[model samples]
Target: MVHTRERSLLPTEEPLSLLRKDGSPVEDSPLTMPDDDVLLELHRRMVVGRRFDTQATALTKQGRLAVYPSSRGQEACEVGSVLAMRAEDWLFPTYRDSVALVTRGVDPAETLTLLQGGWHLGYDPYEHRVGPQCTPLATNTLHAVGFAHAARLKGEDTAALVLLGDGATSEGDTHEALNFAGVWRAPVVFLVQNNGYAISVPLSKQNAAPTLAHKGVGYGVPSVLVDGNDVAAVYAVVREALESGGPTLVEALTYRIEAHTNADDATRYRTSDEVAAWLDRDPVDRIEAYLTSRGLLDPARRSAVAAEAEEFAASVRDKMNVDRTYDPAALFEHVYATPTRHLREQAAALAEELA
Candidate 1:
């Protein structure tokens, strides 16, 4: 009985992976492959997603975006997780997950608005079922848990997927959120994209766990670890978790091939060789190779996908380039339902200055 009780709480012995680095299948893997239609869609989205991430990063250099955390090598994790969810499910993403946001159908321009120094969310949360891209570490997990628990109380079948980094597992809020999700068995999935760094700090310094997925067991949540570069594996794992009807924590072992963000210099801490090794494991290339090997993709299909991605990048570039006027007074409007005396005074002072 004790063994039975603990059976579901432990994570897989190894990080589940469907494909090898050479785009070959893993022998005797535990998970089955997704259907051909699903795999083809994953490949196309990954192509667009990589182009989107590259375009966003370039925007940071061009001063169109204040900053961007490139998800260059982690497209599989971003696209797979989003594609696994149902239309009604909610996604809580970190500031690094702009690719995931785009995969969820949010307008690329609206997705970058927060990084463009805008105070308000560019898109409506209700319409997209996505929260604002959270910059603060691990806080979104708490929100995800609360929303999932509330949905359960209302007898809604909606589930929530919250993305996190390896460093966020050390945050207090993540611990609390996992604990509550476990006890309540809320329909929420916590995806930890362990990209191996928390702003120049390596996982060696940030965590000492056997693996991040093991952190979930302590909170009574089932855990699974997957090779983050394998799109089929990621989609399969996340889709299962969302359909499992209980809280789950999934740790995807990916890497940050680029610097932490446009503002940080990664070379100061990481060696050139380290970055090169991860670049060879590029997620987009892996899926494209796999699809071609299976005859699921040909040169014509590949060229068509590239063309579509270029179109997407062009749209984002055009939208981001258009200049827009801003009103300074709009900042104070959302701070309070009714402005206090001090707030009124500040607004008046700003108004006088503008005049």
Candidate 2:
């Protein structure tokens, strides 16, 4: 499998960005800064997403959630990428992208359902234009490409935003989907949240490329790299990619401050210093500093946001405390319209045992 063909690492162009680590604006982007309202909304969503992560992680520790993946330092990626899409666009998320679901207006309680070992996806995909979060890596791209290509075939102008981790870029399905997307001119944006790891494996071991986004270059898809922690940068880059009317690949340089999940210990792989460096570049803090410097968010406004976040965390805890109990038999209910003979017998045996 090691055909070491040396393909030129040629990419479409440089990545887009609009913010510095200290929250200063970069004058390079042709696009002007987002308006006050847009900035305000971004800040609000980042705050809410962070609080959601905090509450979900706490629930996992309390045994309320079966498992939880915390998107702590990556709020900007979830909020900015999701917000970049138009009303008609679809979002294909990963299991870790519960925050993306939250950004799209899905209830915190319901969005955490599958993570808490509840029912299948709790939201309606058609209504929200968001597909359920996929647990299998790189498979979501297949769904995104198929859905987007079908939309174009049907003469609909809908685009799809698919989120994946750095590890997913290694999967054959990801490569095939990107290759097909370019050939078919599918209006789908592939966003790789390069959080440095696929569980315990770091990006260095994931694949070899000048950059992960370069993989899409072979397929004739334009590529964009951006600082994933910068909300403004991510939102701007993703906005243009989704609107390009063709496939694009965006590699966001971000870090996952938490473990891969509640069951995995990140300390076994990463260092405290590495985590601290990313914590210094925290997305929520950067925007708050930027807005505060411009007087957009004063002390009173900050207090209001704190109160709102606290209320949200309290509600999530309360809802999870009395959330619906998990039923083992419910798994087979929606799996098939007509149960197989073997499945029917198992169902009957289980029902009889329960009775």
Candidate 3:
């Protein structure tokens, strides 16, 4: 009963899933799996990404980080989407997407700098091809669309990917960005990690669309709904979207296993039974199970991955545990291309105060 013409714009009837909860492959999916080596690498990165997420959370408790939004259960979406991007492509991540930043080769400690209350951005966006870890919802989508359009104008093949939450879908900026991208055919991809709740506001209140992907149809963008916890499925769908030569919207059905951040209590809004249900479908465990079942991950390999993750976590801890010192005047230096007289006066006064 599906219409052929609109099929390209609508998401699949069900969230596209390649692997079941038990680690068995779904037969006859049109999506193709990456090479075995790539799959193994995905598993390794997911392990390390999860560890970095946990370590960052621990640092928050120890008073090293001012706050951290844990992406613990969402590693598959975080790692899978980043790995799908080419080196030339740019990524626009939300504040909660530190794991994606890490997967994109950003230093773990640097990625947490903003959350640590130290810097506006922890790393150089130009060098890493990543925007600031955006805190304002849906604003990055517009930035991504503009960047992609500019790249196209310059005759570059570069594209952009922007990650968002379900709540962002309701923002005016998100609507504008999608409309612009669709009209211009900008080489941008919108990845909405629908992690059930957007900081305690369950998606039932944020969106009415059958799936977040369906929102794309109204804007003339092709849409895909995928099981966000399935790393391979996320990788494949995002890769296809990037290669589709136009803006596409992908809705990944995942769950945020942790509280919204160090500041929020999840128990007040959701039940432990709900959390327990998702824990059984844990993304990291599913990938590990599949790999082990295929003999690609034996005890030795598994142990090595765990050890590497632990070492990575230790490195982040060592780097973050130190006192962070900053010069007050340095902030004024980057604020403007040409400092205003008022700014200069304030900077001089601050310098005098410090002296």
TM-score of each: 0.96, 0.94, 0.95
Candidate 2 matches the true fold with a TM-score of 0.94
Ranking by TM-score: 1, 3, 2
Over 115-171, each residue of candidate 1 has an lDDT whose tens digit, in order, gives: 998767888889889988889999999999999999999999899999999989889
Give the lDDT of residue 326 in candidate 1.
84
lDDT of each: 0.90, 0.86, 0.90
Better of 1 and 2 by TM-score: 1
Model 2 clashing residue pairs (backbone): none
* lDDT by residue (tens digit), candidate 3, 1-355: 1112223799998988778887888887667766789889999999999889888999999999899999888888989999999999999999999999999989888899899878777799998999998899999999999999999999999999999999899899999999999999999999999999978899998878788899998999999999999998999888888877799999999999999999999999999999999999998888888888889999999999999999999999899988868876677867788999999999899989989
What lDDT would candidate 2 get against the real structure? Answer: 0.86
Query: How much is the lDDT of residue 168 in candidate 1?
Result: 92
Candidate 1 — worst ten consecutive residues by lDDT sum? 1-10
- The TM-score measured for candidate 1 stands at 0.96
| Lowest lDDT block of 10, candidate 3 | 1-10
* Candidate 1 global CA lDDT score: 0.90
